[model samples]
Target: MNNQEQNMKFMQIAMKHLPEGKKILDDKGIELNMDDLQPMLELLLNVMSEAYELGKEESMENKS
Candidate 1:
């Protein structure tokens, strides 16, 4: 997929699990405002994208 499509997919996945992330923070008695949330979400997306790339590379190596 293109970069835009990959980013969109990452966002969808992140949003889907957002509630779970919030729950974890709530259990820890941590609260985040919008400012904090934005960076956290960006970090999550970056990590997810890197992980996806790593897995794709591994799969290609295995196929070879």
Candidate 2:
């Protein structure tokens, strides 16, 4: 997938799990805030994107 598609997919996956994450934090007496999570979420997106690229490259190399 292209960058935009990859980002969208990553965001979808993150959002899917966000409620569970919030619940875990809530159970631990931690408050979950979107503003506080923005930076962390960005970092996670970057990591996921990079990992996807790396895996794609590896797959292509294996097919060579």
Per-residue C-alpha lDDT of model 2 across residues 1-50, encoded as one tens digit per residue: 67899899999898888888888989999986999877878888999899
Clashes of each: 0, 0
TM-score of 1: 0.86
Residue pairs in candidate 2 whose N, alpha carbon or C atoms collide under 3 angstroms: none
Quantify all predictions' global Cα lDDT against the true fold. 0.90, 0.88
Error of 1 at 48 (Å): 0.8
RMSD of 1: 1.2
Show the lowest summed lDDT stretch of 10 residues, model 2.
32-41
> For every candidate structure, what is the RMSD over all alpha carbons to the true structure, in angstroms?
1.2, 1.2
- Candidate 2 Cα misplacement greater than 4 A, ranges: none
| Model 1 regions more than 4 Å off | none
Model 1 whole-model lDDT (C-alpha atoms): 0.90
